[model samples]
Target: MSDLPPSVRRLADGLRRLPGIGARNAQRMAIAVLRAREGWPEELADAIRAARGNVRPCGRCGFFAEGDALCEICRDPKRDGAVLCVVETANDVLPIERAGVFRGRYHCLGGKLSPIHNVGPDDLAIGALLGRVRDEGPAEVVMALGTDVEGETTSLYIAQQLRSLSVRVTRPAMGLPMGGSLDVADALTLGRALQHRQDVGA
Candidate 1:
């Protein structure tokens, strides 16, 4: 490595750990930080530290929350509790929310089922999801996961587990491409897909 200061090297190393950030991008980011105005890096560091310290999983929906209980969306009285949208991660929730088409609550599965990665039902918060469905008594659970094999497996698992429940389970219409992620989908496409969701069988 070049003769960069230890602090700069450490920052680059930390940045490299982030998803999609390679060594070159990490080095660029570290240099950018060094060139920033005074206190910028400190502010960024404080924000990252504070977020890590304060954020915790929502006890009800598995979304990130400031406390040990429900997230802001789950706690909102205006949101419809009768309909629940199931997503793969906390980040997936934002894009769906930004679509402004879904007014129901959400259940974050944390991740999809990937046999290759050894991520099974036990690895996810599936039990919590079933419990939420039982308690909330939602009319429908919308599977808003990607169209990949893992996503399909997860959706099927949820459907099977909830078969005994009175609530119906649905999925988005076949507009989204296979293996596509919701986070990168356009608002219009997501909104339309949500509006035309189809029912799933037990």
Candidate 2:
């Protein structure tokens, strides 16, 4: 590392900040970027800047949207408005969609409650979700979150918050392993879980 040029070192450091990228992997990626065709690095930078500038979270569901527009799912008329699937992050929505079992709308919580990490109800999209439930009058809101401790806590909190509403709060069943997150679940597993969701008492 001491022998590396300052620019290369900086690139490696920046790559290292990505999730699951260790020091060795970041260095390899940085080297690969440097060795690519002459214009690739600039193209990559331009693409990144474009996406960062043009993409934003959907106002209704927290999923990826272009500018102020709704996400594709939110715009689709075929989706069922009677149900809403709630997840932890925008990325988590992909695996569930890939499962092709849920045709309802979605709500991304941004993250779960984690006292150790100083995350609370206010830090998430819980308030928006409650407002949606109240206004939209969905018959069901699936808590399609992880099965970890924080996930359970967040689900319970949301369920309690919606206690006065007529909406039924439920969670996926059977297929997912304990402590598993929605993003890591396979399509088959997610589909089965959604098909067998059980009621959760608030």
Residue-wise lDDT of candidate 2 within 40-68, one digit each (tens)?
Answer: 88998999999999999999999999988
Q: Give the runs in model 1 whose Cα sits over 4 Å from its true position.
A: 176-202
lDDT of each: 0.90, 0.94
RMSD of each: 6.8, 6.8
Error of 2 at 74 (Å): 0.9
On the 0 to 100 scale, the lDDT of residue 81 in model 1 is: 88
- Residue lDDT tens for model 1, 116-193: 998989989899888888888999999999977889889998999999998899987765566999988888778877
**Number of the predicted model whose lDDT against the real structure is largest:** 2
Clashes of each: 0, 0
50 Cα displacement, candidate 2 (Å):
1.1
